[model samples]
Target chain A: MQGMSPIVKNMTRLVAGFIVLFGVYIVLYGHMTPGGGFAGGVILAGGLALVVLAFGEEFARKALTHEAAKTADSIGAMLFLLIALLGYAGGVFFTNLLPVGEVGKLFSAGIIAPCNIAIGIKVGAGLFGVFVALAVFRRAGAGSSTGMIEG
Target chain B: MDPVLLLLLVLLGFMLAGSLIAVETRDLLSSVICVGAVGFGTSLVFLLLGAPDLALTQVVVEILVLVVLVRVVITRRDETHATSRATLPVGLVLLALGVMAAIVFGTLATGEDEGLTMRPFGDPLLNEQAEASVMAPAGEKAPEGAPARMPKSAGGAFLAHGLSESQGSRGTGAANYVMGILLDYRAYDTLGEATVVFVAVLGVYAVLRKVGRSRHAGNESDR
Candidate 1:
């Protein structure tokens, strides 16, 4: 696919970065704010989807390669599990292993922040990968009659 | 009712109308757009209900779903011949709708004293705890004008300790109660949820691309 008109491309250029930034902000501040890993990760994926829609599949693959996304997806899930396992040093599983300081500050929430980051990475990369797999795998113009729609 | 409740009802009505249109529309693109409108309407309801996190997530998710649905419907024409509407599904749906409406209105009509009352929203037990804590006896070292002291608490995160006036000292220490519950008190549940998502994405990847069994000998050549 050649993507949409120049208007869409320009608009995506201006807006997509902010959307990603906002997602990061939400993920990082998850402990202190309303949004956490799940919501912020979805936002990040949505931003990438916007980029892909405006700039075509090739640009999206370049922006976040299929291989890299797959790797990130695995790493995020493993990191989260590793964090949980680290809690074994304490009495129980999923314990707050890191020392928690006074709340409302960035560094005070102990392992929660790290867990949020891990989940964010996993979800964002996994969803973007899902989008790419779904939309871009088919050969261009071959979708009319011999499409994967019935597949 | 209050102005907020009235506004919420109106917004809900709009959302219901949008969903009906989405379901009834013949054109695929218009149906998808109507679905988007209903989703945005639900997002607005979330915002009005003082849940900004849900609103934010809903808005972004709605956008992504809209993008995906619109792109697929637009690019891939559905060549399958349209069949006549089956009566069984229509009857079943209407039956389900009728039962749900009856249950909802019945519960609403039930007084506040009854079980399953809709009046109490979000952690009804916590509400009771809050009410009980208001009459709490002061601790031994209580200072004058100190806020309501909480009783001795159990292991759960909802027991927001009333010991100190400090912001972070609230039980579980994290500022947001939802975060505290999600990460500190019930972190394992979060882990389980993450696992579900992980497995689901993996399933999608596997299902979307299948040439041969993945682990079969010499299957690497498919790449």
Candidate 2:
């Protein structure tokens, strides 16, 4: 699909970065703030969706391919599972194996921060992949025989 | 009425109006937008209720739902007007609403006589009591046959003992109680939820991949 006017494209270029950065901040400061991994990840996906909406399908595909999203999703999930499994060394599943430092600090929450990061990545990538899949499928079914399916 | 309650009532009114408009709208796009407005209103209610996490989640979910619904509406060119259904479904809905109202009123009529205590909204007395109990350590162990002396409210107990050094156990180290509960206290549950989301995304990918492949094959066969 062709993109929108230059105005929309330029605005998307200007705004998408700030949205993504805000999402990252929410995810990273999840332990101290109201927004957590899930909320932040959805925000991140919204940012990506904004880009897709502004620039249309082709540009989004080039920036974040379906394969890349799938890989990120898998990696995020695996990383979360790996973190959980690592707790086995502490003689229990999902044990807080890391040292608990002073509270309110960024690195103070043992395992919770890392867990949030993992969940954030997983949720963001997974939602983006779903959007891409749905968008591509709709495009393909709409008389575009040579759309994302072959790619 | 209290100012917060008054504001909540106004928001609820808007939400109800939005829902009604969404149901009655003939234009699909307008209907989707109306539903999104309802969702946004509900999220605002959540925020006003002091549940920022829930508000954030609701807002994000609403956005995603809006995106998907808009996409679906855009793709399907047919059926511009929504068909009006029979009155039976509406009757059933009203009946369900009546039943829910009856249940709620009946429960409220029962009062706090059933070993339930009603506390003032946003009162910190329970927290203080829990803190006192934690500090005393005298009532930690009750007689085997006697009643338990723990705090009546579980949340206050969590706040008192879940994060700090208490009861000869090291509490969850996370400063944020919600994170502590989710990742440290009940990490397995979070893992399961993550797994569910993962499976859902994979299912979407698989379904789309199959459709794409079949369509491609059909095009090739035609050629």
Candidate 3:
């Protein structure tokens, strides 16, 4: 796929970093914030998507390949499940093992913060991978022969 | 006659109109934009109703959906024949809306038994006295089989104890009760939901692999 207009590219460059940073902020402070892992992860995916749309598919593949995204997705899921299974040490399936620190602090909310990070990573990577895969693969496959508009 | 209710109704009407326009519009691009309008309206309603988390999710998801849909439409030319029963979908949508409306009204309707009906929007059903007993500290577990000293409803209990320094055998210590509920109280549900996302992405990659697409060219259009 071809890159978008210079106007769009410039705008994306200006805005993408903030989007990613905000997403990370939301994920990290999910226990205290209104938006949590899922929402922040989607925002992260949107940031990556903005970059991809502005720069084109080849750029996306180079910066973050399908393999990398898949790996991140797997790691996130595994990390979340591992956090849950580790609760076995507490004699329950999903017990909160870590000490629930003082309220209103960043380190408070045992298992929640880490779980948020894991979920954020999984959701962001998975959605980005899907978007890249669906859009990029089709463009590469049906070039010229399909007689369709290749925009 | 409350102003907040009036505002909520206005937003709901706006969303309904946008969705109707989206469904009725013949042009795909207009339809997509109208759907986005509806989504934005829903997000606004969520914000108005005091659920910022839902509002955040709705807004970002709506944008992503709009981007994906527009990308798909602009990339590919329309080649499929128009459906014969076009109004059938419109009819089904209206029917579903009617059913949903009925369910909403029915759930809100106050019957002979007060326990059955859903409480009004602003006026919650939590007993004021439940607040006094929810101050138990960490390492203290409620006795087995006995009702935990909490508010009547499950959600009420979470609201009372979710942010508390101690929450049954362990201290949840969550500033955001919603986070406590999602991650600590209902972690299994979150796990299943994550798994669903993982599988969906996997399915998309598997179906759209380079080798399979190259081998069976034009097979995509068949679907």
Give the Cα lDDT of each candidate.
Answer: 0.75, 0.76, 0.80
RMSD, one per candidate, in order: 5.3, 5.5, 5.1
- Lowest lDDT sum, 10 consecutive residues, model 2 chain B, at B141-150
Put down candidate 3 lDDT per residue, B1-223, tens digits, no spaces: 6788778767877988999898777778888899999999988988887789899999998999899998887765774454666355878989998998876676446554767566554433444335324533346543333344566554754454443435632367777777887898889998999989999998888777776444345566568
Among all windows of ten consecutive residues in candidate 2 chain A, which has the lowest summed lDDT?
A142-151
Off by over 4 Å in 2: A141-151, B89-151, B166-170, B210-212, B216-223
lDDT of 3 at B72: 82
Position B160, candidate 3: lDDT: 46
Candidate 2, residue B44: the lDDT equals: 92
Residue A37 in model 3: lDDT: 97
Fnat for candidate 1 (0 to 1): 0.56
lDDT of 2 by residue, A34-95 (tens): 88888899889889888887888887768877888889889989999999999999998997
Docking class of 2: medium
Q: Look at candidate 3 and give me any clashing residue pairs.
A: none
Best by DockQ: 3
Model 1, docking class:
acceptable
Off by over 4 Å in 3: A143-151, B79-81, B84-152, B162-165, B168-170, B217-223
Error of 2 at A93 (Å): 0.8
lDDT per residue for candidate 2 within B30-133, as digits (tens), equals 99999999999989988887778889889997998799789767766668655677666878999988996775455334344635533423332443333235
lDDT of 1 by residue, B1-223 (tens): 5576667778877988888888777777888999999999889888887778789878888888888888878876654354678566878899999997876575346356766556422222323433334433455343234444333334212343334453223545677767777887789999999999898888877756534433332346546
Task: Output the worst ten-in-a-row residue range by lDDT, candidate 1 chain A.
Answer: A140-149
lDDT of 1 by residue, A22-90 (tens): 999989999898898888998999998888888887886676667788899999999999999999999
